[model samples]
Target: MKHYVLVHGGCHGAWCWYKVKPILEHSGHRVTVLDLTASGVNVSRVEDIQTLEDYAKPLLEVLESFGSDDKVILVAHSLGGIPAALAADMFPSKISVAVFVTSFMPDTTNPPSYVFEKLIGSITEEERMDLELGSYGTSEHPLMTAFLGPNYLKNMYLLSPIEDYELAKMLMRVAPAITSNLTGTKSLTEQGYGSISRVYIVCGEDKGISVDFQRWMIENSPVKEVMEINDADHMPMFSKPHELCDRLLKIADKYA
Candidate 1:
């Protein structure tokens, strides 16, 4: 049995993986779904997460608890990719493979914030819709935060089930928009984060991330392999749970 660590995106928590977790566990794999800082049931406030490391503390601690001989398949969704990359960098040997599911996949060459900046740049003002972006900290060291709006959530879950969408509306939290730590000059090293095998899953119908942007990221930071869930939306765990699980299982069979 392989171990799978599922990481959720901005404004979401472990609860978002409700559909996918049971399926993976039923298939005899150990699935650990995480709620990043300030997300899900984690009590930390968004204001407390001043840096990328702060936001990723829970995930880092979880990875640290693994025995030296153990390795996991790290699966990151959407904004969770940045913290997942940080974990891979800090514990390369602990991760057999890092699967980016319609998530931002950073390159070793640029700072971790590059992909996020690209996304912001690509989005038009109208496209931003009701999604709320706020700032914290002083003007000299400002930090960003985002809260997904109801209408925006609708777009994100356009193809997902109504029940799952309701669950998200009930559980979503405010998330840091990258944070100052990611804006720093540090980049992932080839000997660290780059050492792990990486795979990218494209959600073709996702309006939240957009297929065009997802493909662009794939080209910008090439991965070991590329897979597609053509009918999936941004929330594939809800929109295409079984298909996502099948792809994950196939990846585990080959890579883990």
Candidate 2:
């Protein structure tokens, strides 16, 4: 069986993969769903998690746990893309393939927020003020609802076929502002991009991040394959598990 490491986005933890994990396991794949240091159930203390480095710890530990010959696949969503790209560079040989689920695939020349602003149109200072008046729950802050955006509320629940909005809502912890604001040590560009294979999965109807943005990420990364789900929105795993699985299995069959 192939091993897969699934990472959730900001303010989310391992819980994000609840539906897909069981299905992947049922299909004979070994899965490890992780909560990043400041996220989900792993926080030593939410505010105590002070930097981007803290966010990378859980993923780094997971990779370190694997043996030299262990075959691992990385599946990252949204902000989790930061760590995925880093880990693949840190331990290239063990990572069979990397997948970005409607996520960023950043390089040193580009900043994460810069790309987001560029793709969806930059958020004006006044807009930031409006978004900060959010209704969503965060572990440390109550203003995360702003990130959800007008479109996030509409399409997030519809992206996947599964009903996971309640769980996602409950797990809405405040994300550390520094992950993107501060800057990462390096990007996929600064590191070796050719060491492992890369794939990009586009959530066609995504509202938080658009279809055009997804294409931009793939066109920019050192990607080898592109998978699409037109009917699904940002939360494809929740709305269209079968389609996501078909594409994943294809990747496995092709590489494993």
> How does model 1 score by TM-score?
0.98
lDDT of each: 0.91, 0.69
| Per-prediction TM-score | 0.98, 0.83
Report the C-alpha lDDT of model 2 over 86-150, residue by residue, as the tens digit: 67777887888988888867754665434544643554554343233233325563322224443
Task: For model 1, state the Cα shift of residue 98 in Å.
Answer: 0.3
TM-score of 2: 0.83
Name the runs in model 1 displaced over 4 angstroms.
Answer: 179-183
Candidate 1 backbone clash number = 0
